[model samples]
Target: MRRREVLGSLSGAGALFGLPAASAQGKAPPLPDAALAERDPERYWARVRDEQFLLPGWRAFLNTGSLGVAPR
Candidate 1:
């Protein structure tokens, strides 16, 4: 099949499966409150790590330099 035909089929299949289109997906969760950070530093950082970043829960990403992964 042609590239366009393949893409069209995939798009239709995505719709049939009830997948959300790019624009339809809602915004990311808001950043945790500053007060939470001050009151409970561990809990605050956990929220930030879990909500802000897209890394898998099983993985540990510790490189925050120029080559670090950006937040999703």
Candidate 2:
């Protein structure tokens, strides 16, 4: 669907669901960096299982519309 159409639908659904306005959306929790693994297997899994998955490049991390990660 087109951007405007999709947004319009979301707005209608939001109202029907009694959700807050679009601007009142909740923020994604911060993700721990891959660098924090300290070169260990345990710490690596810690980030993978907990950190928010973000695509590489730009502010893809801030986009709530995406939940999958593309290879960096």
Tell me the tens digit of each residue's lDDT in model 1 across 1-72.
999999999999988776566545856789999999999999998888889878777788888776675576
Give the candidate number with the greatest lDDT: 1
Please identify model 2 stretches exceeding 4 Å from their true place: 1-23, 47-72
Tens digits of per-residue lDDT for model 2, 1-72: 899999999999878777655435755666566576666768775466445444433443444477555322
Lowest summed lDDT across 10 adjacent residues in model 2 is found at 52-61
Instruction: Please give the CA lDDT of all the candidate structures.
Output: 0.83, 0.60
In Å, residue 58's CA in model 2 sits off its true spot by 34
RMSD of each: 5.5, 10.6
- How many steric overlaps are in each model, in order? 0, 0
